[model samples]
Target: MKGILSGFLVVVHLMVISQTSPTDFLFPAPPNQKELTSQKLWSTQYYIHQFQSGGKIPIVYADGKPSGLFADTCDFCMASLEGTAFVKDSSGNSTIINFAKSGDSSFVNCRACKRFAASKLNVESWGRTLWSKSQGFGDGVKNYRLVPFRTIAVDKEVIPYGTVLYIPAARGKKILLPDGEEAVHDGYFFAGDTGGAIKKNHIDIFTGIYEGNPFPEVIKSNENKTVDAFIITDQTIVDALAGLHLKKAF
Candidate 1:
């Protein structure tokens, strides 16, 4: 009778252990506990690339093949820090233009769409490139494909790449989705890209593309605002948010 009673207790213990969730032990809550702390908040600015159309700005490859069409005002902006552009032709088709360098000159390339012809109506040439390794088409440091709204250029020394962060102030803000539908901001951001101007305690938000106003109003509102920020160390939540950007990114 005593042996049978001990056996029953052992079986029950095993059943309890087996039924327990593995994640409960495997993934523990982060130190910050997902709460925004005053120490984590940082000043932030915004950056954007544009999908320009119906302009007289012309760009070509190093070989003089017409690359794509860009907005008239995009000449200097496209050559600046935001090293990429989405140019649209008269037919309303779009192509990616990445900045490149040839010796002492800067240029742009339509590596994605190579068949476009220059608009002959006195269009201004942005630059010319032959596609060399001296330049690239992505972010400043890691060259990770920039995803608008989700990507941020951070100071790597302060916020390393792959670190997921949450901005409490961004919560409930509405943003336009890729499908043209409006979605509320989740306050989540991924630090996958970096920039020269990004320094300690500063972050540059990538707001994707726009025609008139480069920075969206939602993002512009946060400019220069020292908002509450949180470092998400929880692997589960990190994967769900950060993975969403990395998986879709190149």
Candidate 2:
């Protein structure tokens, strides 16, 4: 009868409603949508006890580079600027010019794409990044892997050398690239290196330098940002960073 038909339709409607995904309440994506990979989480309130700091890749200028960059002293100038490059002429070849903090006054905030750098360019991939001196550590090693992220310099008094740490991603506005690419921090770093600037609760993160292409993105992202760090007591993880014969200074 008519009553039975109405009840059946109501049941069908309820079934469809139940099948609806709950994600719709959170992220309502359009036709084509994209997301990022999953990283661990960090709580700044719990892990942080002191003021955070930043490290940098000195902007090397042509044939006239920074001074005393050898032997014992450092005189490298460093900075963090998100550059926006534009293709000025589209003729036989594209002439692209990037405008950043140190660049010209004209093409300042112009961009080719919004959120441009957050794509698969992979921000976190800048892990093994740094800008060491000519005679810095590992300059003579055949295969030295103790310079970048693997060898984060820490205060020996606070977190001793050879101690492993698991830093989860901190909740904050996504660190955006020059072109709008976004990323958070989440990974394992070892306490292996040291420096005069690195003291007390201060931890130095080394994202090895890339001669012609220093890792500006990683340098900018981790600069002075405080996030939760978990002391990794797991022997397996610690051994991987400390090698076979090495021991944790803890």
Candidate 3:
């Protein structure tokens, strides 16, 4: 009886341990938890663009008329930070001075969400190639479609554009400055509004219901969705045209 009772107790202990242990598949342990923090020197938001459909050619505007050619979306729509004022009272009380001046620090317009010509044509060509090799070009190429997309703004300095970044939660400790000495944030950038709950080094991404168009819909649905992103930046590369403009425009 004693031996049997002891075996039963061991089995119960094992069961409890198994239940309490963290599952490897569901919640994998992070590589370095101590290296992550939220302190940041400069925090700002930028836009994000996501592609959905393929095949429809984007219309271009020339003199307020349709130019019948494709135009890169980001070429026209620009994103920038907004200026704000902070006020304090004589009694050591502080408050936001103005609300009207608070504007959307990060945003993208309709023109900035259009499809690229290269991507559209490349997809079409690939479909034709695949069809010709397998079944027949006529049947396969008929369904070819141009890809469409939507974009939002995130932080620019923290997550460099054109690099894939993953946000673990809607909020988490971002790994900024690997050494963890100075104030900085490293992780995915998220879009935030002027009046929203924004921390010094945190971001707030937007998501909402919209038209059935897959392009824009995907971007909207991505709110709270953990994803690895490849961000791009316009300031990283050196361009002769930009240098000339800088000298001439000023």
TM-score of decoy 1: 0.57
List lDDT for all candidates, in order: 0.49, 0.31, 0.23
Per-residue alpha-carbon lDDT of model 1 for 1-250, expressed as tens digits?
A: 1333333233323322112121212232245644544334454444434443545545555455666454544433443345555444556444445555332354343221232234221112233322211211234344345555667778889888887776656655666533344656666677877655567767777655422222343344333646657787667777754544543333
Q: What local lDDT does model 3 show for residue 35?
A: 52
Expressed as tens digits, the lDDT of each residue in 27-51 for candidate 2 is: 1112121222222221110000110
TM-score of 2: 0.34
RMSD to true structure for each model, in Å: 18.1, 21.6, 25.3
Q: Lowest-lDDT window of 10 residues in candidate 2?
A: 43-52
> What's the number of clashes in each of the models?
1, 13, 24
- Candidate order, lDDT descending: 1, 2, 3
The better-scoring model by lDDT among 1 and 3 is 1
* Candidate 1 off by > 4 Å: 1-48, 51-73, 99-103, 106-143, 210-225, 247-250
Which residue runs of candidate 2 sit more than 4 Å off their true CA positions?
Answer: 1-145, 170-186, 210-225, 244-250
TM-score winner between 2 and 3, please give it.
2
